[model samples]
Target: MEILERNVEKILAVLSLLAISLIFVYIFKNSDASIINWDEEKVNLNINDKVYENLYIDKINVPPVKAGDVVTITKKDFKLSDNNENLVFRTYGSTIDVFLSGENIYSYGEDLYREGKTLGRGYHIVKLRSLGDKTSDLVIKQRIVEDMSYRWVDFFKFTSSNNIWHEILINNVFGIVSGIFLFSLGAFGNLVYVVLFLITKKNNLHLSYSFATMFFIGLWNCTTSGIIQAITGNYEIISFLEYFSIYATFVMYLFLVALIKKKSGKTKAIDIVKLLSLLILIGATALHLSGTLCISKTIMLFRNYALIVLLVLFYTLYIDYKNQKKYENVLLIGNCISFALIVVHIIIHNFNLTEIMDITNDNLITIAVLVMIIIPLFLYFLELDEIEKYEMQIRVLKSLAYIDKLTGLGNRTSGIAYIMDLIKNGFDYYIVMFDLNNLKEVNDHLGHDKGDEMLVNFANCLNSSFSDDYCKKIRYGGDEFIVVAQFDKVEDINDNIKQLFRVIDEVNRDGEKGYSLSVSYGIASSKEFATTGYENVVKLADERMYSYKSEVKNQICET
Candidate 1:
């Protein structure tokens, strides 16, 4: 049972790799799939039960045709109305033996003259034979013309054989090879790691492996279409398959954008840019499908441009390495190498310089090389020393900027910047201002250390009670804290603060020293001072806080 199951798994894996390889091979083979038009005039028609027709062009450039031959011809749009049967002119290679309706009619030299001429226009399939005892090679071609009678058709001509099909086939083969490698080495490992990571509840590691799998899958598919064209000399199939590969890449690109956006939180501007790029991709695809455009040239450009973007993103990784170093360094290196392989393939394919000697789709195998070799090794080399330096630099800068290290809250400088940004954007938000009571008396009775502890405790309580989504917390000064909530309405701001304060009171009652911490609070809505801006809101909230504090103090004094 185990052996059978293993065999089935192997079969499935091979099939998947084959599928991806075919897709990429198809794309690469049909990079230049546009039709090439050749000019031609009247081809001599020989109706042979036994008849010979000789067709010749003297001065004009025509696709080559000789006497005594059978040819298949096609035009853009022309139909023969004789029984609605499109004409196919046929003749023997050597003998001028012609048969109409399976009955022998005539031979060229014995029964008819070879110099007989018949001219009919639009597109014609003409057969001819030289007036000799020996036979020559058979040639066939398709032609198009405006008017056949006037157009000059020259004598036999030849053209260099097209190698586009050959190149396409080889590319498709390469695609297959690369796909197999990616599936076996990169994606297999990634899949295993993803499943294991998720089972172990390592969400970050799971994310890394999941992304790795997708990236390699895309890589595998993009190259296989090229390999297909390399093997079988079929251009039409290659062109059709290329469309699939491009569509696959479009999907992968979207997935990449979504992954990055998910990590970076909400950024509307970046989302908008990605949306525009997606629209362009869709437009290009639609054009190709409708046969109005062939986007292979554009796709080729995008492959290289995508590499440059990937390189830039790699630098961004280096820039952010410090902050992201705690988990899955291995996955980062894997991603980098996978992207590098794609870049290398583009360089090799575009420049005709990959193998230096023998060229094949196996070059795509380099992605597996990176995943199985480079990434694992890079992970081992990861050190915290550089990251530590970055964090230390950030710490020093934050101290000088607007971080209050004692309570871990934003200080005056950063607080002002945050509020000013909201005001510049012309948003409606609420400002809540508050101050701790009885600090001086507590400091005198229990020393400055106890007073400092009380202040830190109060900051911690506010931090825990308030969420950053709706409110931005700030240490306004000693014994004072402020929160600016950005939103559309004042009631939401008021209700949220009331709920947060109730939670804080509960937390205080749970116990802390002999005395419970208390504060007087006030709120100012953005609507109340739309013309006055953020500074006015701050001033108004502070004034309300002072008034509330005085009233509470008066109540205490009366008691």
Candidate 2:
């Protein structure tokens, strides 16, 4: 009862200390106020001075552990703050067994290995349970199953009640947080884009795919950080996710590239590259899950394959740039950045240079994945803006094709199409053809500008005479205008012509211009000429208009 009460108090104290330490980690990670005693002299696993070397040091040439090597590291009579405190360390691609005084104290990953599975990286927090009073040798035998980027197991200091994840997170919080940010951004962004596409019929699915790729990138980042084991004890599941997300993210990235380049009509290059890389990724995944060959062993191949994809796409982007395609330069810069990082990773891994290594090479990889997802988004927005602008220009050109500039009405082509449409629909309609009385005289006597003004005033009169619901006013040519209207009866057609004459009278009554706007028009109804075509009706209207012109001339002579 007394020991349990003491242990609980110690645990509370350690938790409070870790809480404050986490604040420092977020605010300033290099603060001296640390919860875990990182100093080798006070927090080491060994009571003797021999165990103090390379404890939590960032760069050391500790020998690389190979598969099937059962290396034993023993600590005799290791000092512990209390019986409740636990020993913690990190190992990659290995199984571990701990024996205290020749009795098995803790064992991990053996069952997974027996099942022909790769025991993923583990943050082992071995509990110190033993004869409370006896001092014994703590023997740790680690069997390496695969060679990794960081091959040596690092023994981190002890913490109360298996609370050792804070130390690993403290030094590497930026990459981890960046990973979570990417994951969150991708998840929310994908949901919004997908919903937008489904509901509003907006096609931003390529951006959604890009977001999905970011989601997998974040998953890969979090899974390999070795902090997930502390959060959830499912190392096997996390390990699988770590590798599976790699393949998924890579494939999604390739798919996004193909989607972008597909519109360029030169997709053969990207298609071939994607196909070959896809085949390899699929094969690698099958073998990895089936326990034939682990996916960790195939990362080298895939990364090198990624270089090929980038190289081929580089040529594709160059061609697009030459052709002045939008967003190509942005994507080119992104590809170059990623290509350079991949080169750095390859160089570091090939030479095994610990001098430049920041604990693990995976952090650099997370940045590369971030680059692939984020850079595409910038280009997507640029492309989207350019596409909308192009569409607007097309609409303007189409409008100009059917409109007359001087009269602000439909042109001759529009009148012909409108007349033919009314005839085709079998609608009871009226087609009125009007010719200005003295347009040529106005042009020859008062200059062409006055003639243009008269033409515009008459178009305004036509517009005011009929509502757009069933009327189309067209400036067919100089001094020749057409008005097409649908009406229930010919009486309604006469009423509109009366309105047209009234509007012309109003315009002349204004006395703004020196000349009066006069028009002679002849109307033909579709119902009256069901057998005669629209062209014949228009010809009859033209003949009547000439007769009206003669009547106007005769009345002028009498006046």
Candidate 3:
């Protein structure tokens, strides 16, 4: 029955993990941080022979206004007739129109401009005003009105490329799937650690660091997609969300760096890089929001550079993995290639260069992203098992090297290494050498077993007294020990030695032992050694210990 219960629990755990993984995959695949923007609007105008040869305005800005609002065409600059007949103009979408003949101008809607219609072949600007109670703005688009003799150039048509739309959809779909897979792979490592912690009842929260990193990634993607969806039709909203997500992406990368260098305390470099990327994103966003359409178009060029950074990261990871095969960070490489492909699609669309590769412009990149999500997810699962085995080996090796076999205290080699580190770091410290008063006598009288007990007890006392304090205790030899620590003055060192002696005296007075466990301690400080090496200082401490033992012997003889 107990075995059945355990099996059921295991099944439940597996099911829960699978469910969460699927949900995460769904979120990664379906989310997007892009808004829909309307393609340019086009209208056709008929030109009469009389006024079509005169002054023309190419574009105009018309704000939201109610009916009967007299729209003004501020004699805005216009292009000459395409063939010396009609002029074409791009204008803001308002509910108004302007009549132009030479320098003559009048404002009205579809009616007044009818009079100025002439045998011209060019574009003209017209303002618009609303006819209803509620005022609304229009997205002004270019229109071409033709006359009997209208030139071919005057027959303007604004067409948005369907190819661009297809490319965006395909690239984005692929990207989404791939991204989710990569994320899931990374999460597998954390899941393994979390399960181990649960089974052992140990607070091994190391995996939480990675979890926090991936949680931010998921959060950022979720926030970006929702914002993009909400701002689909609002220009201001779209502009704001674009820059926000771009900056957030950089911040996420910086956070990842922090996770990798857990203890380096060099987070400022990450902050600086994040700040620069944010500035670039903000600057591009601002240029887009301003009236400069060309500058807005230029931002796609900057995005190409960001893609380059992703490539660099991919190669760096590959190099690291070569040196240390343990790091199979597949997401870094998978996402890099996925994003690179998407960028290629973008470039092809922007420049009409589709001959290089069999690139599809129908959500192919989106699908690529989706596919990438699986790479991380599965890779994470594999990495978790490898990491556990590696950590186990490390623990075993460390135990052999640093732990004393007899008493479990720090071993002689570890003690020497610790002191060497302190010396290299220029720490002024005190070394207290402790020797068992009569270990040979105890061994001769009570056999090696009793002597071993005395040694164990002595080691335990050293560990108990100094382990929780400022001192580090080590089993220096068979019947010798040492305590090392940084001290401000010799007086502090003296007080600690006196406390050690008092503890030994108390133990002896209590009886019940074969030869009371007592130690003769010698203290040496860096300050007293002046220019001497650590070896010389240790020798001095040992000599002092013998002198103290001699005094104790004399006192015992008198008694």
Candidate 4:
């Protein structure tokens, strides 16, 4: 029944994840949108003051133009069916102005350009309205800065205001949801760490690394989702976050890898990897900030470098697994899967393959990265399981150490420790020493097993006489026992001794066993023993117990 319930729970959990994934797919896929590929369309380009007609946008073989040069693209005989619709074009590396039939219609960054200002390196959206003409000429003039290698305009389309809003929401839904989910999970992980730290007062390195990695990855997802651009409408801020997130994510991942290696006690190789990763991150950040490298181009280069780092990390984990480091196995499996997915994504991305399930290969790689982040949480739980097992074993060993196997009383080792603790804490206690009388006679008459039976009866009588709250009983050694009782006065110790005699009498009267149990005892108070030390007090008690045993033997001989 329990197994069936557990299976049901597993099925429910899987269903929940699938349901959420389908919801994300639905939100990201359902939109009435169109993309006009410039590669397939006939366009004309004016590069470096030279005009080339009937050229494919992708096949344009113009020389690279210097900074401050002008480039124009003219698409003649263009037809417009909806005059009210907006024509949106995404462009890079230019300040653009749209002209319809040689008349100015829309200008992008013209005001900022005239003010001798810059919006920095980013993609800008240029929008213009149609003239309701069946056939008209469209001219796009751009003032190019830096090299013209990154200059391109594509995804041009006529869309209504409502349709445009739907397209933005649909396109960015996956990113926004994924970012929020990853960030929330990371934050929750940090919260759990805070709670555990408060309870255990130990810093856990894995949790820290997992939190940092997820946080930066979440930031990258949000920035790349396009939702930030849609909400803030600030391309500069979005662009900066986009580039910054890339470096931040890489740095945090390196830290996570290094931490894992450190935990495994194999840090030299990962430390080198961490140093190299940091250098690359720093170098990329410097180049982007110094304007020596554009954001898009820098990110492109970094991606290839990152792939190498990932491969190196995978190899390291593989080596660890080969060494039979059980903890590294999960990491190896997760990294292998993520690496395969990322490789496939890189291939599809580089070849410009068609997207599946309305998700680009880039999005697929993001999913794989998320899987990597989640794997650590599973490992953390596995570590917890091992810790719990270790604690259980320690508890069992502790039981064996302190408990007497025969009498179920505290053992001799624990008795001495208890006495020392009482002395150390200045606790006032009465030490009672006992020796079983005639145990050898009982063993000779019946058997050693019968002697053990008498010993058990004596232990029971001792337990019945003293409550645990005020007294502790120890099976000190063979045919001997010791009990420590806390009391304010000597009269209380006398009263307990009287009660002990009564309990022994009752046990003998019951006659459950063939022999009657008898014990010789001597008591010593802490007040008398404090000046003589607890160990000396125990020796004094042993001497007094032997004296009492001689008295009992004499009384037996006379009777």
Q: RMSD, model 1, all Cα superposed?
A: 16.7
Q: lDDT tens digits, residues 1-559, model 3? A: 3344334334433443475457556645664424422122232222212122222221211122322233232222322222212222322212233433332232222542344321111123222322233322222222222211101221122223333323233324433343343345336645765675567655423234334334434333432223233224232343344344434444455445434433434445445555666566667666544533222233354456556655554555554554443434565556666676767666654554334322353244433433343344344455455655787898899889988988888888888888888888888778888899889899999898879888888877776556545577888888888888787887877766666666677767866676788788788887787663678767777888888888999999999
Better of 1 and 2 by TM-score: 2
**Ten residues in sequence with the least summed lDDT for candidate 4:** 31-40
lDDT of the structure predicted as candidate 2: 0.70
After the best TM-score superposition of candidate 4, give how far the Cα of residue 138 lies from its true spot, in angstroms. Answer: 6.7
lDDT of each: 0.50, 0.70, 0.49, 0.68
**Residue 501 accuracy (lDDT) in model 2:** 89
**Greater-TM-score candidate between 1 and 3:** 3
User: What is candidate 1's CA lDDT for residue 260?
Assistant: 43
- Candidate 4: residue 402 lDDT (0-100): 86
Q: What stretches of model 4 exceed 4 Å from their correct place?
A: 1-84, 87-155, 163-166, 255-267, 282-294, 318-321, 325-337, 340-361, 374-403, 407-559
Q: Per-residue lDDT for 441-532 in model 2, tens only? A: 88988899999999988888888887767889888787899888887777887898899888888888977687898889888776666584
Comparison by lDDT, 1 against 2, better one: 2
Candidate 4: C-alpha lDDT: 0.68
Clashes of each: 41, 0, 74, 0
TM-score quality measure for candidate 3: 0.49
State the lDDT of candidate 4 residue by residue for 460-483, as single tens digits. 888888876768899999999999
Whose TM-score is higher: candidate 2's or candidate 3's? 2
State candidate 2's TM-score.
0.67
After superposition, the stretches of candidate 1 with alpha carbons farther than 4 Å from their true spots are: 1-403, 487-514
In candidate 2 the C-alpha lDDT for residue 481 amounts to: 92
CA displacement after TM-score superposition, residue 28 of candidate 2 (Å): 9.2
Order the candidate numbers by TM-score, best to worst. 2, 4, 3, 1
